[model samples]
Target: MTVAEIKVIAKEMGVKTSNMKKVDLIRAIQRAEGNPICFDTHSRENCGQEICMWRRDCN
Candidate 1:
């Protein structure tokens, strides 16, 4: 997803994203959703979270 879209999601989640990078914003969002802050850290491209919303971009 684009930064704008991510920012929107962050906004809805009450996260301040004005100065956050893409990765940071995504991790923050995950924390807000009570998920792990594991964005872009899939070592083998095989994440265990089957229903992860960030799967498409979390390479």
Candidate 2:
């Protein structure tokens, strides 16, 4: 998906739309696609790192 589409969800939840990537966006979509609700609003706190899914590998 495009950054604009990701921005919509982030906008609804008040997350800043800068430096976000497709992998993270796709992951977020997958995480929320079927749940009744998604608490993950793309916050830096929620995402935790630029490479959230792979950060530990670097560490």
Candidate 3:
């Protein structure tokens, strides 16, 4: 997703997104949602969290 869209989601999660990179922002979002800070780390490998919302982007 674009930074703008990520920022919007971060805002809803009360995370400060100013100057945050995409991976960092995604990690923060994952933390807020009680998930692992594993955004973009899939590297095209199969991730165990099959229902992850970031699955497509992570790969």
List candidate 1 stretches off by more than 4 Å.
44-46
Candidate 1 per-residue C-alpha lDDT over 1-59 given as tens digits, one digit per residue, 9 for 90 to 100: 99999999999989999789998999999999988788988642555787787887887
For the record, the alpha-carbon RMSD of candidate 3 to the native fold, in angstroms, is: 1.7
Q: Model 3: how far is 54 from its true place, Å?
A: 1.0
Query: Evaluated with TM-score, which candidate comes out highest?
Result: 1
The Cα local distance difference test for each model comes to 0.86, 0.49, 0.83
Worst window of 10 by summed lDDT in candidate 1: 42-51
Write one digit per residue (lDDT tens) for candidate 2, span 1-59.
35687668765665555676755554454455542222244354554456443233222
How do all the candidates rank in terms of TM-score, highest first? Answer: 1, 3, 2
TM-score of 2: 0.34
Check candidate 1 and list the clashing pairs: none
Cα displacement (angstroms), candidate 1, residue 31, comes to 0.9
**RMSD values, in order shown:** 1.5, 10.0, 1.7
Q: Which candidate model has the greater lDDT, 1 or 3?
A: 1
